[model samples]
Target: MATQPREESANMGKSTWLAFAVHILTASGALWALLAMVAAADRDWPMMFAWLGVALVVDGVDGPLARAANVTEKLPTWSGAALDFVIDYATYVLLPAFAIATAGLMSSPYNLIASGLVVVSGALYFAYEGMKLPDNCFRGFPVTWNMLVFVIFAFPGLQAYSLAIIVVFVALTFAPVRFVHPVRVKRLRPLTLAVAIVWLGSAFVAASDGMQAQGLTGIGLAGSSIYLLVIGALFQLSDRMRARSAE
Candidate 1:
């Protein structure tokens, strides 16, 4: 009777608190990025990436967790997307850019320009209104410098191409290509998610070995990365072909 109203109120408060906790999870990424910054400053690339990986996992889960908790409905005042963007730019762009500039991966002027372009281009990429497409794909390269830098560190051989990589990807920042959002975008979602997991697992193993991914681990990382990078474009092409056939 009277207890029914009390129980319902208690349940409502519980949902609100759950949403608040989700926000806290999102904010925790900033702390991980801070630690990663320290590691990068000390030239400890592996440890820095380990922290970044933790942040990545946090970022991945927080979106769905926020949705499940109905954070937008409960905490309309707080913008999870805004907070996420801030954290993401720091973790995905800023810290990796710092590492590139500091790690001596390239010669003087090239390193200087490449790292500078990373943050600059990353800022523009994330701020652009059309950065993400309606189908949950990124409209352009999406400024994944963190992943690119990790790959460079893993294969030391890529050091020769560091400058070119930056220049090309920076140009691609505004290109017409579609980049996969992995766990989002329902087409081939199971395969995409599996590839993402493989990539993450490979990342962990590489981080453990001082960011040097060798042997089969290297192959797994490369394969999964290629799949993620190309899948969205494949989807876009498939749709275009289907539309042409219909016409």
Candidate 2:
């Protein structure tokens, strides 16, 4: 019976250490965001996207890590979710908005306006109570300006259309559109994860090519993007039909 106390203490120590590691992992994205911001300020699209890529990776895995670490149970006082949201806002919304505003994608005043719209809508979306639906899909457009802006930067041809794209997405933020949480959504998870992985690979390729590509990587990126857009709507349609039939 004497060893019980030692065992419990060891377990507690391990759990506490894991919680701290998860928090540190989540916070590291902020540093990545800072680096991305610096690159954006220099109008270095390739370098900016590279940094954003690292942040994206950190964001992707930290959720699972936090869950495994039992962060909430181990550190009841510290809100991992809140910390994640703060980091996400900085990396996903603010940094991307800054990039858009500075990329010269749109004409002067308009670029600033568009960037402002992105920031405002994304912030609102993050705070929204109904941001996600029961199916693990995002309720609307999901405030993924990082991905959108990355695409625009990758394809120089899309720059001229940046304003239109931004306006459409901002509107879609509340337009009853369904955006899938690639990893969280259960429906078609295998396909979704496979495509998402390919998308990330293409992202690496896109970065290595200095945002100028002429190969399968570019094609894979485009194809995966189109799939990401279409799959959720397809699932939404299925859901609507099931509901109608049940009714």
Candidate 3:
């Protein structure tokens, strides 16, 4: 009789865990989608960028939260993972593409080709690397990097030149190089950490300073580009360090 009761209790615990896991995953997805939609409709570049930043911050926490809650261990196999990936791609890739198109970034034939290449390259890299498990290391430039590049170039006055720079960075994102996960700080190379800090710091400064610029487009563009380049270099160094440590 006691054994039966204990078994039932265990089952209930499992059900509760599963429910919590699903809720978290669903909430994360909804938040990302909502932000994306807001960005799409408002067409306010700063707001769009702010939302993306928020999404990134949320994403950084989800994994750890799930793990700490043991959600990954107890939740339905692949359900949470699948939903997470879908939401990620939607927020990171599809929405950005829509933003670019709606913003008329593709008005020119050259711009159109460049944008298409960005999409293709990013898609292929995602498809190839995303198939693996644990995702300890990324095989190509992360889409986040490319998306940041796009956001930087999307500024009003720098639109044309920024778009060109975006195309170049997109190509780099597809380049056959590994990018290290930021979570693995112990294995992070010095150069990678330095670059990452500089890049992120620059972004912070730019965002802060631009708030006072009123309508100065170049201010944000220049700051964001510097941030992206440093970020890229950090990714490269981190990836190399991670690969070496793993070996």
TM-score of each: 0.97, 0.96, 0.67
Per-residue lDDT of candidate 2, residues 14-131 (tens digit): 9899899999999998899889888888888788888888988888889888888888999999888798889888888898899888877888899899999999998898889888
Q: Stretches of candidate 3 above 4 Å error? A: 1-19, 22-27, 104-106, 130-135, 145-147, 150-158, 189-247
Question: Candidate 1's residue-wise lDDT over 1-247, tens digit each?
Answer: 9999999999999999999999999999999999999988888889999999999899889988998899999999999989999999999999998888889888787777898999998988878998878889999898888888898889888888988988998998899999988767888889898999999999899989878889989998999988988888888899999999999
What RMSD value applies to candidate 2?
1.3
Give the C-alpha lDDT of model 2: 0.87
What lDDT does the true structure give each of the candidates? 0.90, 0.87, 0.58
Worst 10 residues of 2 by lDDT: 209-218
Instruction: Give the best candidate by TM-score.
Output: 1
Rank all candidate structures by their lDDT, best first, as comma-separated numbers.
Answer: 1, 2, 3
Clash number for candidate 2: 0
Task: Sort the candidates on TM-score, descending order.
Answer: 1, 2, 3
Q: Give the clashing residue pairs of candidate 2, or none.
A: none
RMSD of each: 1.1, 1.3, 5.5
Off by over 4 Å in 2: none
Position 5, candidate 2: lDDT: 100
